[model samples]
Target chain A: MSEVRFGILGCANIARKVARAIALAPNATLYAIASRSIQKAEKFAAENSLPASVRVYGSYDEVVEDSGVDAVYLPLPTSLHVRWAVTAASKKKHVLVEKPAALDVAELDRILEACESNGVQFMDGAMWLHHPRTAHMEHLLSDSNSNGIGTVHFIHSTSTMPTTQEFLENNIRVKPELDALGALGDLAWYCIGASLWAKGYKLPTTVTALPDTTRNAGGVTLSISASLQWDQPNKTVANIHCSFLSHTSMDLAICGSNGSINLKDFIIPYKETSAKFDFTFGAKFVDLHIGWNVRPEEVHVDNKLPQEALMVQEFARLVASIKDCGSQPSRNWPEISRKTQLVVDAVKKSLDLGCKPVVL
Target chain B: MSEVRFGILGCANIARKVARAIALAPNATLYAIASRSIQKAEKFAAENSLPASVRVYGSYDEVVEDSGVDAVYLPLPTSLHVRWAVTAASKKKHVLVEKPAALDVAELDRILEACESNGVQFMDGAMWLHHPRTAHMEHLLSDSNSNGIGTVHFIHSTSTMPTTQEFLENNIRVKPELDALGALGDLAWYCIGASLWAKGYKLPTTVTALPDTTRNAGGVTLSISASLQWDQPNKTVANIHCSFLSHTSMDLAICGSNGSINLKDFIIPYKETSAKFDFTFGAKFVDLHIGWNVRPEEVHVDNKLPQEALMVQEFARLVASIKDCGSQPSRNWPEISRKTQLVVDAVKKSLDLGCKPVVL
Candidate 1:
């Protein structure tokens, strides 16, 4: 329980961030890094300033074979997620997979089953959910608090980043053979995940892709918009926009009957140690509807570590509990990842049906 | 040209605000007020502290008939706009009608035609359009400057207010015979208008209503969500959510290829004299992607007069120009209102078709 050793598979650009995250996480250690080539693994370790004690492996199998590594962080391409994640899980290593979790729900389910069978902790690398600001917003969204935002009615979120022409043409994300889902996988994972999180992981009854789906020449989505509608206990609708052709933006706005919350930098904070969101409660128009009675109050939350490090630390804590105390792997994180992947699949299905509504 | 005389043709709650706006507008004067009964008009005048010099009339016709009144502000229900607006135009009075200018674009067209034939100016009472903050935002949205938000790709806006059950059942806005369109007409007008304004009045290629449309017992839409897609010289998508079921919110966020802008109180400012919006230009994730390199900068703009007063002043300026300088009536305001109404009709049509996409 002293430290859950993390072995990172693949030398993806994102893996470098996770490497730093593991180094920052007090409860987690950067034990090993693997790439298709030993030189690549060694170069990644050097570039990220990994300590000499960290192991460099030529193959992902070597990291999985190392019994000292308790967890594997899979930052591989979406197409290779199922193979590597399932292999890591089968090796009794807890899994922290980068999102879009998999190319589709089927692949995600395979990885999930492997983790469940092996009694390994599972979580997707959605670092924002680990931020202190997210917890602060969740407190306001809780149903037990009478003063919180009343029964949620609407949620809007977007994850967009401008990509250069060269990146669009050559990057792994937009390449059909590497990241087939393209922007829908790379960017919309955040937006769709945020929506599901806001709704407490209640799967939507229907998903409809907007007509504005833009595709690259290789039939990969470059930009897309979709809506998820929940028709059960209380009707709620969530709209998400994800694109690789827009300015960098990560906006999340949630409105309930009695209040609303909004944050512009929901995916990544402007600063590493602090974040803020705007919350307006019991807002009413002043007499004659000239102005609001109250303005949105800025609520600031500070964190001792970056959200990525928090994610690593939390994953390590869960893995440690299971390894040391013989506790079962918590289903909470896996369930969240499953539900988010299910919605992602639904969105893709909706698009496949020519922007028609896909009933869940 | 000293001051264009103004007359109000209803005793609705909003009329009180416009009466004050007319009084505060330097180039406009509150010359007359009208209601179904002289006693009601006199009571409204007394309650709103109207000056004794302001005339009170028993019927809307009297306000139109008064040769001294240069313009009439029609704050009547949506059902009454076409009739009153046409009558005022025929009487050589410039018309300033409250939004959802008419129940449908057909009625709006008739009203516009009447104003055109009579050589009288026409403007919708969308007060937010006249705010100094709007002009400042417009400056940032302009394509002339390379530093502004470049080629807007997505726009998201919401106009929602929590309504009491009694209001949902009895308020004129939700009553089938009074406003008819309910939240779509009353609240969505601002959101739809905002989308159009951000896009420089370019009509969307298609409109699709989300399945979360909620209706009152009288079959009036109480809440609705819709997306407008523009497929032309550039591809842009806009999502709008308007409801009488959620907490008060008027949010507008526009994301472009180079920058983004966001404001919470878009329809009405949180304060009367000043407003602020967050603008982030050239935003990029820092190396390692842990956080953004730039945060949204708060841009504040102040106005000497309330937005409503500024609206009245602008309308009066146009009216005076026509009356004193023998200038032609400007088509800009009427065209803006017409485009907005067209989109409103498209949204309603899509809802009527069971949330299908309606081609514009």
Candidate 2:
């Protein structure tokens, strides 16, 4: 493939953003887009200003089956991810499914198996992981200096996006049939993923949902908080809170024995091209305890391309490698995605079981 | 009373800071300091630059019985707070005690009873509460505007101060006989007090100690995390983590439905003269979810006196009202102190009972 041809599986609002990313990525092309309604697909393409050569399809099946389309980006609702992702994979198209990749780990397992059997690459659309800021943070957290952030002791993350009353009453996210996991799947996915990332993708020993949870009338969770614990020679704990009823905020703080990393905008940077995080090593009180001896250092990471575009570029790179080199799929992406989904499943189970601990 | 004369009990390191605060307070004076040894008391007075007129006593009983000592600033260890506080109060000296106040609520009640019988004012030494920044944040939280922070959803606080190996092994905080409550009393007291302040002093209905707790060989906790739940019509939850093993960090974030207040320095401000906190109301994502539409406003509060000095001044004002103006001792101080201790006892109970939830 001269350039990785991309096909979007839906005309969801998020698809518009990713379509632009595909157009910006040098190694990717917006080859096709599909929606349940032909007119909706055409309108989305026109509004997003897709190139004239791009094709439009009335059904998702047409896009997945298109031989020219080397990859499919599944931005469908959670309930449709398993069916559409598996279908896309079986059609020999690499899959970049948006998080929460599936309703639960079981559904994600089937999708991963389908991709493995078909020899197609699989990646979750957690765009933040592709950002340059994440790399800088990872470097600092893993630094071995005595003053650096030592062994991770705790991490806490939150993503709360407030929705209007009308949206709450009518949006697909709050509907049990559309996004069955609701806020837990849509918002908590990032929080849990961030926690796992802070811990270098190590799964926690146990997951416990806190007692404070809210659900819509349809029994879809609107808000939830859960904690994950790991015990060994050194103990570490992580807590995540996600809600659709609070003001918009995305925060992540990784506290270590020697230092800490704090970012108010973890999921999405406040600026498209630049991101910043505060890091502190061996902070102490000044004499007389009136002030700090050392203040946290704010580190800025600049990226030439937007994070979403970087995500597309990365996905296309893997696809090109596989098509040209006949290489097996990258296990890293699929493994991390599966682990994140497993934690989501455990959190849901803990919540369902009256906030009891669920051993993982 | 011409001025509130303060008697210092013991020569703990914290007492040095508080002694300076008493000297800086316009309406208070450091009249006496007592230690087990006359040499130690004299050395402390000389090292701290106490005035020549300030009396140095060989025993705490002498300071409490000194006729010129109008109040006692008891910076004793947690295990000794009850004995010294009650004795000072019973001698008709107003009591300003360092927190945890006592090991448990029962010990605090006896001190309160002694203060009531003698008509002496009582106040805990939570200096941050007196900071001007706290009042500003409180105003924003209680604002009724749609953009203001709405009803409380949760509060998360932490106070982690790293100690040297020598300090951890030899300090009174880790010694069971000297400070039995350990980090729970030394650090978590401020966390719990901050949470209660965020909720207008309404105690939580349940306190559950989280699973990640570290203890010394003497079975004294050195680090702990806990969740407090309020199950009224509008459910709320609060989490607090305190440790003596992590690098110094004091964080408090009060998240409400409409807005949030975040501060990295809540226990001790980064500066003595001024403090700042971030407040955001109804923050939203910009177009395409690339960035926030409204950034958090950094509100700075300046004070002429340091927080500790303000605490001393406030305590002295209450004492003066009772001694000179024929006013009743303020019940607010002791009431909130008792409630805070009650939650502390509950957390200790929960930690002792295999991390179970203890009903308030």
Candidate 3:
């Protein structure tokens, strides 16, 4: 099958990564790039070492309208996701948009609707979900044998990055005009998405923001903490903390009745070639409760391609099926994104309601 | 100085561990033990291979009244703590009580007042605090140099252990008559104590219980989640989850502006002689954000004595100081215990108030 041709909607910092991902994905190829200014797009292409055959456009509209492009990756600001993603989907180009899919689920719904109407695939840029390590962990979580971590009881996750004073004041992520939701959207998305993914995409019964929400001068969240509780008999509770003011930490821990899965660099691997997570099954205290009977076993999963490239390969595979075999777009990716967005919205509402829990 | 003779109040399962610790501490000795039944006390001594010099008594009052016993270790249930701890303190025997300190801060205060009035040293048995690794982490946390994880911003910890249906139905930990606080007291004590220790024992401004409180049939909490938020300029938030329903997990992660410290076995090390934690200092994403610039460095600390023995040695040293050097008892340990109990009480109040936030 011919490789899916990709067009990037913007020359944002994240676009550099996705552009490289497109080039590396065996089933995908970088076909076009764009920026508000043609010179900026050309500069991005040159800086990222894009092939000479890659076209540079001044506006995102050209990328969406391109006849040869099979997919458009939108690395635009959160506020612009709806406008550009809808445009790409309406043009029959599969949409791969940066996270915090939109400002809220309402805007994300419009983008989803456009994709459904146009028969185009829609997937958010959560590269970790595509990592082979995730699949390995899922196996352990789902296995009915002794290998599985039995019924999940609690999950804890965090996404935090230290920011410079200059970035906090001027970066698009912290700017209301560009991101709006700030750290809540930019960082918590990973934590919330991870919690949902750990629970097989089951929505929580309620979302409550903790009173520790810190805001920037423009009232955009700088840091936030929230809880998502699922009712019985799947009575699992997840705590999520995301901040723009802390040192780098991407931790995820899921505890179940018989075991637990833990990873420190969950959002992004410490290295691209392989990732490791600690899995402890049937852990119990030794006699006299002096120490654990068994220590956590480190499980390392090697991937031939980086997680982002794998994401692109998977997305392009769906695009190829739709284009070549007349198959429908995959609903799995869209459903995951939509559920994540709904929880994100609930967290925002809870924050606005003075941390009172918003029942789903 | 001569060894501080220790008397065990009850032959609970945990008492066996403490008896070994007492025997191991160079400055402590197991002098006597009582279990409300002379036969049970004798069986405990014989099963534990206790020294023939050790006295076996039927009543806790006999051990408290014995002038040869310089310190009394209370392994009694939460309901019996105040009565025994205060009696031991009034009798001028230094007290080393199991955690939860007491049913509440009010009951704990009676024990503290008695200790203070009698000039008997008081300390709770949170053995992890005495581990060399804890001191190593504390050094990093307090360091003014780049080695320090600057200005703490977040802490996440969990203390969970799987329980059998039989244990859940019959264990004293789940019985309201013996341990009304249940998991909140037995498990959360470690998590809460770890968080406060990470923050240098500073009290949080508010304690809010999440709506995920699960209770046993006797109205004892089987699982609970809560948040502790500090106000500016400290501005740190801690999330803690404790349960008897999950597999064993004792995780603590502290994130600051410059670094993070994470350990999966914070309360009790997987091994006894040496313990390790991951310290990620000055971490940042590599260019293009493909991976972290630096992975968490595993920092290991070794100790000659087991943590429990070290705890006993420290307690005995403090007792020896007051007995031989005519020095006043140290105020630090008692203060730490008081602050932890206060937070525990606040969480209980919040749970009772339907998971409302209780201001300090």
Candidate 4:
């Protein structure tokens, strides 16, 4: 609560939003920022209103070594997430790695272990789950008034690929270590986090990955799809999909038992709403939208990045949990590591095994 | 356990398959057949090699009221499912009604309540879950070998449409009681059953529906889409876009952490095994089918339904579950009822709200 001091690892666009969020949070402050280039870092430091005492490190190692930082926010490429996060944690700084902490699971597990052994905090920066919209979604989904809309079964989240590529987006499209998964690693985490949060964090019992690893200028995914099941008290299954090759997906589509809620275009201001299907006893008619039975309506617009803000606040909240909550730390480390690895491993398996299901 | 003596409520196509399954399973028998004409019922009874003592009824009411029967299979039009099933339950008989048991939630609820209160059983004759293919899907998704592929995320299941005359022959499409829901109700249930059974029987917390209710000379959906979320231990989700309008949609696409599996024209089998999309995780490059992904080298198909045989074994299993395990009745009643009503209500609400998320 003592002005949660924060440091950012890059000057990525999202980093700007996240930094802005840190500044906006009443108890949070953007105290430091680092980049390979001093000019960009200086620009970010100045524009974001960082204090004079707040320093810019040309090297991330310097930033990670900085004792002034309490939490390190990593906003680097998918491939670099693990290396930097583990380094930050080893230096005893709490880490908030960007969504998809690593390109694959083995690396993710290592980072998680480093956090545990080093006794530092670790959180995936999937901020959407922290948004009020998500809280409302959880409330809407769990409310009995929705009647039999029991489990949340699917999430379709598509963040349109940036038309204007940044200078740093190299090797994302066609490299062995860094391949098509950049899109999946980036956009998919939202769907994963959203679904995980919706199901009250039920771990998937199984996973099967399907990737649209179409090479070259054709780009990432014409469309990619995957499926998994959860074994728990209620027993649920899910399918999540992400694509960076199309203009079609603009939102998250959440389908439940009793009805459906669409968080239209989560990355921008777009249509958002909930819809129900009609079925009365023996005398009613089935509902139809226009000529069809399904359609979307806008109920809210998230013009601001509340999720990023809440994510930092939640990180703040986690610090409290580590000190006072149950015997376990604020986050479920082993579980998160396993699940994260499960996703990345699933992706690798798909490329190796030709995209059939494998048990988690 | 005493036999679950099933009395047929119609001479519909699916009834014959159920009858055959009844003959194969323990503790169940197809005792009678009912139609508008006793001749049609008698003919069906004879063709299927039923006992001469098997009664033929000219009206559905007689079959529901028969004291010799323990349960009645209601395969009448969508409009009549609730009326007959509830009445049969009221008469202290169990009911295994066909899909989309009612066009709306109110009627479906009434029927459910009636059956629950009467201490009789109720189930939807949803067949796919009873098939072994889904079990394989469950296995592939949960196993760890498939992990590098990432989590199973998205799937779209589609079933093709029948012509105007064909739809009118089916009660679900032309039933005045169903009104606008028609095709959405028809096609949505299969996807519902798949998602529910895949989840080990849990309802969705969020449902987003978008329907194409255009009648296209057939008074049914030309295209329909829905977004579902099942956020349990393993975060999962799906987008279901179907068409009673498409000439063909014998496809179910599922992606996983390590791979993906697809049932080719499952409900209505295509002519060749080559029509399938059975995939798993691996590191080699794979070819892509124009419309669907093709990874046949590593594909493993659990069961491929010959359109004719799809319902036969499932109906048998439902009968066996009811008779052999009276304590639990049908293994899938709660799941079936919950999913059926969910889809029905979702369709109604989507129509009313113009395809928006209707919180359960």
Candidate 5:
């Protein structure tokens, strides 16, 4: 109980990153790792340079049932998340699952329910939210003083990563059975999360999928664009586009009444050591419509640890509070995850119905 | 003729800028000015430092019919463009009309037809297109080498300018009968033009207005967002949003299969002396998804003349080609202007029909 012992399920590529994060987190230990094949688990451990005392298992159930494992990091594919996450939570292990937590809200609800019933901490692996840069951006957006960016009127976020032909044809993400939401679930989740995060997690009144959506043969979306709208008073609209068919481009811009903020590398900063964003206040063209009177101010945030490690450390702190101090699990992380999942579900539904607006 | 003699009509606010451009254009001479009242025209001429030889007229017809004037710059409201532009063209005066050229494509066709019959040069006053930075951007986008950004898959452009309460309530743009298209005609025209310009002026297959649209009491759109789609071989999607309710923000981002480009000041550069854009080729997250493998390269394009002056100079050069060299009028400008207006009309139709997709 002195340290948060973490067990990772699956040997997915993303799991390798999370495993490194768990090892680097000051309050966490990489206690166990499990793959379908014990040899594969051993090979992963050898390749990642895990400590000699780390346990290797052939089945995910063994990792969950191990009494020494205080928490589970589930980096399984979308189709496998529900089964493993629910199982880990039911076994009284805190759950930290990769994004697109489940195929849909219904499946994600079951995982949340299990965690609630078992009194275990639950957090989605949206690492960017834990970055110091994200906190700085939130401050810029929420500041109400003279220099602050006023009420946000619009937000646009995009996350795109082109895949190789071989991967597109064979990757689990493009297969409906493996990841039914395809690019919408894998990439759009980040865009949707960003839109929500900018608005302080306020759910939009409506969600509409743009007609430019493309889907693979298995009816899994390969690329999608959507707009989220808030009614009356605030009168805000946000647009998000995600695709596996374009080059890697992760950008987010928030425009307020008094100013705007732009981030070129929102999902992942251009560098781990430092991140930068630009903020412009009272931008106006000079007399005679020649040029702007003021240019955007560039702001930078420095971080010593990678965002994933920060995410793991933050999750471990919550688990420690629950395990050592006998405190209740933090509801903030789970609530934000649920809201993001709900918006993702709405976008999928709107796309399914031929780009119709889904009232949220 | 020693120079292309230019006449200014309506004495509108934008006319002041074009008047200075006319004076700066070496091949053009500001010969006359006209307004409904001769006093306003006289005031405009004096305020803009017009030469003593510049004559002031009370009626627009007087300026167009003056034997000394060889070209006319029409900077009137949307509803008045068709009247003044057609009149000027019919008088055999080469025409340069302000944006939202005639409120709709059908009206613009009449103005274009008048120029065709008169055998006079025709151009829409989209001044940014004349900026040296624009040609630089076009070069980067069309380059197909290993270091070049690849084929574009999507584009997003926005032009939003917040107006004061008094202006919103009393400005001619907010009046239904004057600038009937409101923000869509004034601001969204820039967004649509940027999209069309990025695609080499090829029109989209369909245009759909996003549901997040607002209209004022006078039945004029105050804010709007729309998506333009191209089908088949070169699948592309572009989104454009324009509003009079948000702070000044003009942005354009083009995402290609192998690279991408971003510009914060597309409509008007932050500075007239030099403008810059960022281009990234093969941008991808580095190991552990901690940072980008290649950051965007900042490219700056320097301009000795302001964009508006360059626009006037280009128009005068084309006018001189017909007058001094007996060359045919350049159809490129009018053609691009027509395509932009067509897309604007489609967006208006889609918004009118409750956000339905309108075929181009």
Candidate 6:
């Protein structure tokens, strides 16, 4: 289990953040950087003080075909998510693409076929799932005896990239196509993944999108909602909500037979910042004792072991597994890509016919 | 100044309550009883203590044609709602129909035309608007300064007969021809009307229904949701939620910028129910002092009057108004019926296409 040299694809803000964590990660090395501009890539590699043995590549494909690097991280635009990821996977290189992975399903299928046949790994980097509190929360929602939650109910989650007039000038996520994908690919995918993964259901049979088709801000839904059946227990139903128009602290809640499991915010890394878990159960007649019923559980931090750093370590380990064992759990590209594409297809179909049930 | 002699259409439970209220009304008098079965009408008239001077009619048309009866109250089955109401209106009598004025939009239009041409006042028995508390709650939402409700975000008003296994009955509101108007008509209509009237918005450009369909005794999702824009002081959007399957609080909230005004159980007569209007502007940040910059206020209420009595009084007053002026505010049958039909059509369309946006 020696370190697998990791080469960054593009110098995205998220890439920089991840690469910074990779530097801190044990058994991981930032081997090289590759960009469309060779000068920029070399500068990025030099600034990071990459090892003398590590070599920067001129083209994206060169990095994928590099003999030294074991994995390539693709933080490319959503539209090009599949193109490069599939190219890298087909070259027998393990790949980690950004959320959305592909704009639509066709690209996703190509990536799935390429990765499976080439004996390489392919996974979308949905960082929210890596957040430590997510698993503990999933357990609380899943346990029937806990009575902390009943039949799965409504789920709504929102995240905001807070900025002022000064920052808006430099912000690229606001550009229209990016805005559409940002709203869907950025915040929505997390909710989609969490809603499906935690509640144990697939993409909704029905969906809709009210993309802000207004001038200067096209292809973005200021707000979109769909009524859905999540196979609610006791013959009930569920709805998964996503929006990026406004920031809401209205976390996720599972209303159940006896009580409810209310999460503070499921996306953000609990160990990276201050976080707490809340659980409420009992009859509806009883008033919600804000923080009373919730057992005050501060996400315990190992002073010496950084959890986010550990997540990167785990990702590196996953990369090594693909190089050593031909494939890994993370490389189950067909399954993950299929689920991700199903959600994207549902949203797009909703936009076309107003909103309709689109089976995955 | 004299009482308008009113004829009871049938011996239904709702009709009984209404008839008793009419008997106690200062300007209205319950003078006769009518039923398809004359014997049943006589027994109903006697048990309800009808005046000895009043006559009993064997047929509904006979009751409509009787000069002795100044007005008719129709509380028949869903299919017969429009037929009987229109017949009585055509006979030059003021008509008050039960909860749902018509089973379908076309029927509502025919009923409205019949009433208008004959100069007969017609109204649906939606008395919740006349409640003082409901009116006051609406006023509070409109005020964002002292009241602190910023932007009215969403109002989820659910009144489901969840435990009542009455879906076994053949309800016209649940009919397929009604276009998924089951929940929209049966329950969500109140939420829709209350929100629409409160916000004073005439048109909703788009509507989408999520897997919107009809249900039977299994408690269909008359859970309808519509997002309408309120171009008030600030650009505000509202979600009026209504459902039948799940038990929801009988309340509405003015979810605003600074705080929220949750009208506690609007179904209870505002005069008799104890309710507290609270403002929680920015409760998310602990050290933020108040939720918003403004001082928060809490007004507690105690209902001293019988709750149902107010709607009864409003109906009686409207009855007297039509008797004097040939119409009342609630007697704008053309507008009500048109709006009802448009919404019903939209619901059906939304359901057919998985709640796509229906342009107004």
Candidate with better DockQ, 3 vs 5: 3
Query: Model 2, A188-285: lDDT tens per residue?
Result: 99999998998888899989898889999999999888888888647788878888888777888888889998888899888898989989887898
lDDT string, candidate 5, A1-360, tens digits: 477999999998898899888878899999999999999999999999989899999989899999999999988889999999999999999999998889888999999999999999999999999999889888878846667678888898899998898988999889988888998889988999999888889999999888878888889889888999888458888888899999889989899888899878998889877889999889888999888999989998899888999999999999999999998999999889899999999998888788889999
Q: Please say which candidate is ahead in TM-score: 1 or 6.
A: 1
Of 1 and 4, the candidate ranking higher by lDDT: 1
Q: What is the lDDT, from 0 to 100, of the residue B87 in candidate 4? A: 88
Reference contacts preserved by each model: 0.91, 0.59, 0.86, 0.02, 0.78, 0.01
Better of 2 and 6 by DockQ: 2
Q: Which parts of model 4 are misplaced by more than 4 Å?
A: A47-51, A143-148, A152-180, A211-213, A217-223, A230-237, A248-250, A266-305, A320-328, A333-338, B1-185, B188-360
Tens digits of lDDT, candidate 6, B58-163:
8787788888787788777556777788888878877777656676678888888888787666767665665555556666566444644444444334333332
lDDT of 3 by residue, B1-360 (tens): 989999999999999999999988899999999999999999999999998999999999999999999999999998999999999998999999999898999999999999999999999999999999999999988847577898898999999988899989999888999999999999999989988988888899999999988998899999999999999667889999999888999999999999999999999899888999999999999999999899889999999998999999999999999999998999999999999999999999999999999999
Give lDDT tens digits, candidate 4, residues B309-353: 344444445545545675444435744666657765765565567
Who is ahead in DockQ, 1 or 2? 1
For every model shown, the clashing-pair count is 0, 0, 0, 154, 0, 21
Give the per-residue lDDT digits (tens) of candidate 2, residues B173-287: 8999989999999999999998888888888998988899999998888999888888874677788889998877798888888899888889999888888988888788787
Q: What TM-score does prediction 4 earn? A: 0.50
**Docking quality tier of candidate 6?**
incorrect
TM for every model, in the order presented, reads 0.99, 0.98, 0.99, 0.50, 0.98, 0.62
* Model 6, span A28-79: residue lDDT tens: 8877678888887777667766667666766777788777777778877776
The true-versus-predicted C-alpha distance at residue B108 of model 3, in Å, is: 0.7
Q: What class would a CAPRI assessor give candidate 5's docking?
A: high
Docking verdict class for candidate 1:
high
* Alpha carbon deviation, residue B191, candidate 4 (Å): 8.9
Q: Please write out the lDDT profile of model 1 over residues B138-198, one tens digit for every residue.
A: 9888888798998989999999999898887789999888899999999999999999998
